[model samples]
Target chain A: MNLIEILSYGFIQRALLAGTLIAVLCSVLGVFLVLRRLSLIGDGLAHVTFGSTAIALALQLYSAASLLVSLPVVLLASLGILKLTEKARLNGDAAIGIVSAVGISIGIMLASVGGGYNVDLLSYLFGNILSISYEEVIIAAGLFCVVMVLLWLFFHDLLAISFNEELARVSGVRTNLISAVLVMLTALSVVLAMKLVGIMLISSLLILPAVSALQLARSFRACIVLAALQGGCSVVAGIFVSFLTNLPTSAMIVMINLLFFCCSCGVRRLITIRNIG
Target chain B: MPVEIVATERLACGYREGYVLEDISFTVNAGDYVGIVGPNGSGKSTLVQALLGLVPISSGSARLFGSRCDNFSQWGRIGYLPQSLHLLNPIFPATVAETVALGLLSLKRFPRRLTRQDRETVETTLDVLGVYDIRSKLIGELSGGQQQRVLLARALVNDPELLILDEPTAALDPETRERFYHMIADVNRSRGVTVLLVTHDTGVIGQHASKMLYLDKRMLFYGGFDDFCHSPEMSSLFGEHSQHLMCHRH
Candidate 1:
């Protein structure tokens, strides 16, 4: 087969398209999540997403249906945690930590019991980028479009709310609605990205690019653009390295992101030193 | 009644254990500089949140702009600068202008981003605070004083009818504190913005505020600044060195 045919094979094409869209959606959400110190929340959402996937498998449903059904369920679950932390005496981080553990444990237990032994649990946990189908890509692409449109529409409000939620509310931004929208968007992105980035390494995709962009972006508009570029680069570069070296795409992507993170820090430090000198 | 910007009645709040503050009633009127003063752990912060409905009010009610405090759909018209903001995301790459612009983000719905009006307001507020030149500077690069101003200017960017600042000058040098105090006074006088600030700076309060709320277990004293400073209990609370605080304002 020629290069185009090899790349156009159902699974490979699926992986590429899904990865590109998922990367875009996630990196956008990542901007706020990392800035707001909710990187752990992104990680936690992955566990919750896995629980949904397992439930979908057990129920014999389409994976997309599973994601769709579970996205809100998991978001509601986390929102429940947030409200509890506010009303109860529990520490917020500790609460989310407990929820994450419970979710993954339940997912594994359910999957094992359901006897879907043919599907590699480990592969899904890390990411099954090569296993994606065109159907998955189409679904991911649609969600990415929705998120992008919404983000563009509320860019100013989202930026402000992310920076200072309470102040944003006081200044006339409907911060509560904005926050709920953010959480919902994050959940949706996590679901779409789970197949490409996989559950384990996905949070890296959700965070590193944002940090990298934050170091270099001189403006909010610049930050979003750079974050998108970094995300696209990481995914593309990771997939290429994986194909050439016969490594896992997900692992390669995360390593690439870490490399970007290091370079960003080094460059920023050098700039600071130069200015000082 | 030109419409009180903030009002609370018998508002009670504390941990699940019990109430640390209770039965406090007050109203913040236009151009009123109400300084909330109290010792540490007296639920000052809790009261601030309760007023905003961030923290649940265990008893009674609180209102902002004639609506219940917790409903944030109409929150675009209020201005709140929480204390302990120093414990916030300090290293996030936010410019002075971008940070302040956050305050006005809710005025418009999605699709249209920060408009010329929003940027103009942000720029004017920065200029008002004398930080216009540093508008593009990152928040992390600024000194403690400048960062504090950045946060304050963010609170002021919306030009809300009422500006509620929790310990607005708590983390600045005395000189910087004076500048901020004057800035606040200017906003109140020039723009007709109502002001309610929680502070431990009785000296600054004496110079600018029209009212004071002294709290320990509850609203121990809530009235004029003059009456608050002269009362023997209030006077004794400051100790023998209280006279120094009286002469602090330049």
Candidate 2:
């Protein structure tokens, strides 16, 4: 099939739309998480989703119904992690590590008990864009719109809290509420991105683009815009490359994102040298 | 009699571990430039935190602008500069103008858009602090003194009735520190803004502050600068250096 003919396939179209939507949403949210020093929370929540998905598979739930089961579970685990770090005096990293370890163990145990880990479970672990369906695409797109609208409405408050929590509180920004909202949004994005990038490599979607943008952008607004653009570009390009080379879609996307980060670093260094010269 | 801007009655506050400040009591009236001076670990920052309602008050009560601390919601009326701007992530991307604009976030509704008046306020503040030329530069690219001035501009952008600064001049050079004190004094005198400045540099603050608050885990003395110089507590706490530090030429 020619390039246009290959792209005309229904599965390919669904994969592109779903992948791009998840990429943009994750990148924008990633800017705030990266700035607030909570990038690792993405990894933690992704692992929780892995465990929840395993439970769904063990119950023989359908693909669409499985998201229903996993999303709420991930959100609760996200909030639990937040509470543990805030009230329990556990260090943030330690809290994430504890939750992630428990999640991975549960998933491993469930997979072992439920017929010794099938091909279906392996696809979720490594990501298979070819398996994306029309229904999942619609769900991902709907969530992308919701996240974008909410972020736009609360961008100022989010920026204030991300900059300094204490100062934001003193300024009457409702730091606690904003923090909860951010975590919940992150959980939703991680859960949705599970099929796009899978459990193990999901954080790369949430972190790499934002970090790369920060290296080159001069303002917070620029960082968000650039990160989203970078994420969308990487997702589309990675899908095309994966289609051509028959490689794992998630791994290819991550490799592309790493290339962007390296190029950003080089550009920053060049700018610094130019100024000095 | 002038209206009291801040009043704390026998306030005792501390972290979960132990009490850092105990039985602290003081009042700041309108237009008063009260400089709080203390050694490290003397709970100066902690007291500031308590006043701003960032720390829980273990005992007694504190009020701001005639409202209880817990009930006080007029945060826009108060400007606060934390001791360390270093708390901001150095790599977090923000322009000087955008950083200053955050000072006005509380004044607007969610999805806050800058009004013409807000823009004017930001510009005038940056100009006042002599940082308007670099308004578009990233905050991380500025020097220490420039960043301090930008932060000060942010604090002053809201036209606050009460200005609270905690160790604002810690990392500044001598000339910058002197200029900063002068700017603060100008605001207190010309704008009738009540000032509560926390610092360890007794000499510089003593030259500008009308009132002095000496603290060592508790209130040692709170009165006019002249009285602080003559007080027995000042002499005993600071020994011979009290007179030298407090008697510098204005």
Candidate 3:
């Protein structure tokens, strides 16, 4: 079918809406994570979601039910990773590595024991955009609103904490509570985006747009705004390209984001050279 | 009697592993330009953190503005310039103005939007610190001294009654450091804002600070600069070199 014809389908519309919202959510939260040097936490949480999904599939749970099951698990894992790195004195990357390894192992073991890679499981592992439901679209939209509102309400506190946690705390920004909320929001975003980008490429959605925006934006506010714009544009473009090329939607989306990152790097280099000259 | 802005009685604080500070007792009253001097790993930062409520006091009590540290919620009344501001992410995306505005914005309630007065305050602060020219410039693009001044502007924007700085001049050159101290002295004198400056430069303390806090894992000396120069602890800690330095200053 042609582009207009494909747009007529409710599933396609749902996928596009959900994908765009997830992109915006991920990019906004990604700015904070990247600034705080916690970008890898996205990968860790995504892996945990994979493990949770595997368990749900093993128990013959519905897709929505499986997502519900995974939500709390992922949130706990996010907090656990933070505690491990902070109080337990484990390096951030090391903590992420340990958690990610356990998650993937659980997923692999469960997938093997529960009658091999089924169609539903395969779709979740490597996202199938056509399979996105109307319910997920509504859920993604709801989550996008929540994330945006919270980020708005806590923008200054988050910025202060990201810049200097100690000073933010001293300024009475409730550093620990804000950080915990940030991690929880990140977890929610990761889980919400799983269907659109799947486990392997979920972190790309979180890191790429923000990194690209950082290459061009000079201020924190500009960085966040540009990241959201980049993320939203890339998602729409990726979905269109995937529709035209009949490629895996998740992979196509990541590839488009990668392209944006490369272009941004080149632009940044040009700007720096121009300024020097 | 002068109002006690910061009072810690036998304060002991440490991390999960061990105590960095033990039996630390000191009091900073209003309008006091107190310079806290200590060697590396001397719990100077930890002590400041304790007062700011960033670190928990394992023993004794810490008070800020007459309220117990744990229960103190009036952070807007105090300004803090952490030592790590100079070591911030190299590509951190913030303009000098935005960075300074954070000082005021952080104190406001949620959905914190800058008011006209807040903008004026930020501008005046940047102007005071001589960083107004670079207000729109990215913070990462500025030099170390410039960045330090920007951070100072942020700390001053709130009009805080108590200013706590942790080695803020560590990254600046001698000329900038001298100027920075003079600016701080001006703030303390003109605004009646209490200053608690953590530094390694005993010489600067002698020249600029009215009171001195000498720390070496514990309170070695806490008194006027003249007394610190004549104290037995100072002589024992630095031997004859401290006396020589003190003499050279006079």
Residue B122 lDDT in candidate 2: 93
**Candidates' interface RMSDs, in order?**
2.6, 1.2, 1.5
> Which candidate, 1 or 3, would have the higher lDDT against the true structure?
3
- List ranges where model 1 is wrong by over 4 Å: A1-12, A61-84, A87-89, A172-177, B1-3, B65-77, B109-112, B229-250
Q: List candidate 2 stretches off by more than 4 Å.
A: B240-242
Top candidate by lDDT? 2
Candidate order by decreasing TM-score: 2, 3, 1
**TM-scores of the models, in the given order?**
0.88, 0.97, 0.95
Cand. 2 TM to true fold: 0.97
For every candidate, give the share of true A-B contacts it also has: 0.56, 0.73, 0.68
Candidate ordering by DockQ (highest first): 2, 3, 1
Per-model TM-score (chain A alone):
0.91, 0.97, 0.96
Q: Native-vs-model 1 lDDT?
A: 0.77
lDDT, model 1, position A48 = 83
Per-model lDDT:
0.77, 0.88, 0.86
Q: What is the lDDT of residue B83 in candidate 2?
A: 66
Off by over 4 Å in 3: B15-18, B84-86, B231-238, B247-250
Winner of 1 and 2 under DockQ: 2
Error of 2 at A234 (Å): 0.4
